[model samples]
Target: MQTQCGGCKQGGARCCCRCGCHSTAASGGGARLCSLSIPSGRSRGGGGATEICRSPREGTRKAGRQAGRMATRMFEGKDHARVYQKYRFTPQEALQKAVFSYLDRKAGAFGLALDVGCGSGQGTLLLASRFQKVVGTDVSPAQVEEAQQAPHPDNVSFLACPAEELPVADGSVDVLTSFTAAHWFDIPRFMREAERVLAPSGCLVLTTNTLDMRLHFRDRDQELTRIFQEFRDLLTPYMSDKVRLVVGDYEEIFEAVPFPSKERITDIVDKVPMSVAELVGYVQSFSMFQAFLKDRPEEAQAQVQRLQERVLEAMGEASPEARLEFWNRQVCILASRGPVPDHDPRS
Candidate 1:
């Protein structure tokens, strides 16, 4: 006999509090935000899960803050990066919102949209709708395979390749972009590849979201704030020296690449709602989480469970069906790469 999974039966299967695995569902019809809900049990294929009872009131601001603090303290090494990559393995649903979020800001016609580090082609499919062609590539073979299976326009394709060596010919792409993963990249080499593949009038778009909760809560929510402060402290070490270099000033770094474009930079502040379980799922997708699990299995497993409880506890009267709003800052750097320089033979 198969066990009935509470999460799968209770509307959505992404929230398995028992297993610390979460699912993300995108709103259909191209909504700008992706909504997440917490389910009760582990996902066991089909609908197999066991339900357990805890106070729906367990989800409180104070608990979530504690979970966030522990999470921050846990993910501080290379192991967490591995966990971060796995987060992309779950669903491509977020791609539509993420891609549309950028394209809606772009002006003029674009021929091709290239997504670097396009794990599983979520963004690739979204871009396909707006441009003549879309190409998504990632360094992981499993991700490439998953991306290949996504429904896409004839003009959209997925490939497995490192960011430093994209397969496309020089100047063949019209728009090159990345979402959230640029910080993990070899900044100089990735920029060089972007410069090489983009057409004379092509554009390079890069954006990343910094998770901030202080913007989401009132002063009465001190517990939530403490949790995030801990999370931030935990994540500070492995942010990659390269990513740190780009912080505070997108201009200085863009110029370092000599992208040769009139640049337009913008900052978008958005409120994202997530349950405590969903928050764990989000962090599980980060590199820090991956690194933590790889190098410290016992610690990682314990931490994941602790985080789940804390998140649920912090929900603070928010309906299990309700949402938790967290603030984020997305920085977009759009640099236009003009025509290539004319090469002249030595006199």
Candidate 2:
């Protein structure tokens, strides 16, 4: 399933970190998201004197003050760009964590694997160790360049390509996987292409985590539903009629695409206990939040305050431990090629 709502505009549920946000301990043999406390001495790098990885509240007042002053002067335009690029790698980090967790459990299932949009080679590293042959592909030359430099066994390689048009020949890959990057893909075309490339019985694994995005003064879960509805509306323009049919249901995925003899969908929520500060960092990472502030700064700022206060109230009542939850779903679609032919039926 694809969740495109970034967490900024919506604060509480199913936002960018909305769904991808709340991570919990691993159950059902899959990995879960957890908070890694920033060491005391660790510097909170640029981005307006904000605390590193804490709730937005800790720095919001100061940040708001700074943002107000800087908003007038366009402070450090180039530096902001640099920081954005550097920290924008969170999604990839999350993807790598998921891939490795999968490898830790099912590495022996396939001798060859394909990682689509294998940015920075993080996922490829794990695939290379498990499969005798691994091919990583992406659309960005810069990403591909970085990926090429990453160390891999002789069996692993990286390439640049779009999802609709993969370079690999037909019926060759033993296992096919896409990380959190699949939402950007043209699902129908990618599925057709995936089916074409997989050797009979190969599995196509696709996953994208949506953070929890909440509306101001709305029930936490209610905000999630609103954000999802808004996201659905946003995607309507981008999706083809064929792809549109599959929204909010797994059955649509199977019906529109041919492959997939068997399929299973699992929701893996990473629930981390958090303070107000950590929640804000998670919120700012969202594209919608960035855009919301860009288009409607006054309104966005107000929403930010409400979310921070709501979280603080929760934290006060929370256990001695500050908890943050990063929730995500891992959807695995397994399909078989030719039927049992030579000997298996009787054996």
Candidate 3:
């Protein structure tokens, strides 16, 4: 059975709901003010097959200070990259199936798939399974390195580049995708790049899972939920302004897609059964959690430990696994250049 909130009654069945969430004003507009066009003399695919384009170093001392003034920043450093690779969960199969189904129906070619902001190659490798070639790009060179180190097919490659300055030829990409990473991007610039690189009948798909997760135990669901919510509330102050796009369930993001025939599918819930330790590790992977660690390391450790202890106590001995249902409420924005022709008329 399915609930109004998109939760499933079965063990691992995913579901959805149609709730109207409020959208907030766009942030990060003045943070990195730069022209949308590709810089003059920079040809498409100018970067090598696996190039790492390091952002130019700050020239003057004051330039360094100005760079630090940006409101949003990419996740960097070796520690953060390691934590992300270790703790981040894989993309749900249901979500992948949904994405591929849409592409198969509408996209005219599977020539090239570009996954912007692809951290550690999770979603990039998924695209590789279906597309002829896949390229994953991230602003953080560390993240790109981690992605490159991960095992993947030969057709998959990693590049260090910002979303706005994609090193791809115009009208060359058949599928452009961003998974849980677009909120950190300069939306207008990224959208412009997407429009420039995507082929005439290519497709652009952006997806993100919401933060409102639910935990379920046989008899202590409420208690577990309360514990998780309180922990989330503590991390809210450390979160960046860009997080508003995700909290609104991508309502604002959907509107930003520069296409007339776009679709937004929200409330796609996925339930995964995991141990209490795994659940705690999952929480530790959050960007805000990393921020909290930076600001108050001792307090963050204490709170996370307390959360784990509480979860273990509530789960009882018989059932060591708890249902970690991500009300992943994924907002999948899908848009194609135009209608796809059917070679097989019957199909």
Query: Which candidate comes out best when scored by TM-score?
Result: 3
Give the worst 10-residue stretch by lDDT in candidate 1.
28-37
Pairs of residues at least 3 apart in sequence or in different chains that clash in candidate 3: none
How well does candidate 3 score on lDDT at residue 63?
A: 23
How far in Å is the alpha carbon of 26 misplaced in model 3?
42
What are the C-alpha RMSDs, in order, of all predicted structures?
17.4, 18.3, 14.0
User: What's the TM for model 3?
Assistant: 0.77
lDDT of 2 by residue, 1-347 (tens): 12332222234433211122221111211111111211122224522211112232322233334323322112112333232333333334444565445444333246557787565565566666566567665554345445555455666655445656664546656678865455555567778888787766455666544433332222344543354345434433333333332234344554555653444344443333344445554454344455555667786677666555555464343332344443443343334444322222212
lDDT of each: 0.50, 0.45, 0.67
Poorest 10 consecutive residues by lDDT, candidate 2:
24-33
Instruction: Give candidate 3 regions above 4 Å deviation.
Output: 1-71, 317-327, 342-347
Give the count of colliding residue pairs in each prediction.
38, 55, 0
For candidate 1, the C-alpha RMSD (Å) to the true structure equals 17.4
Superposition error at 40 for model 1 (Å): 50
- Order the numbered candidates by TM-score, best leading: 3, 1, 2
Q: How many Å off is the CA of 136 in candidate 1?
A: 0.4
For residue 287, give model 2's deviation from the true position in Å: 4.5
Residue-wise C-alpha lDDT for candidate 3, range 1-347, written one tens digit per residue: 11221122223322111010000002211111111122123335554222112212211222224324421455676788877877677678668777877887888777678898888878888887776667776776567667767777766766555777776667778889999998988788788888898877789989887886878877677887888889899999988899899988787878888877778878566666677777777788788998999899999999999888777776664333544443345667888876777332224
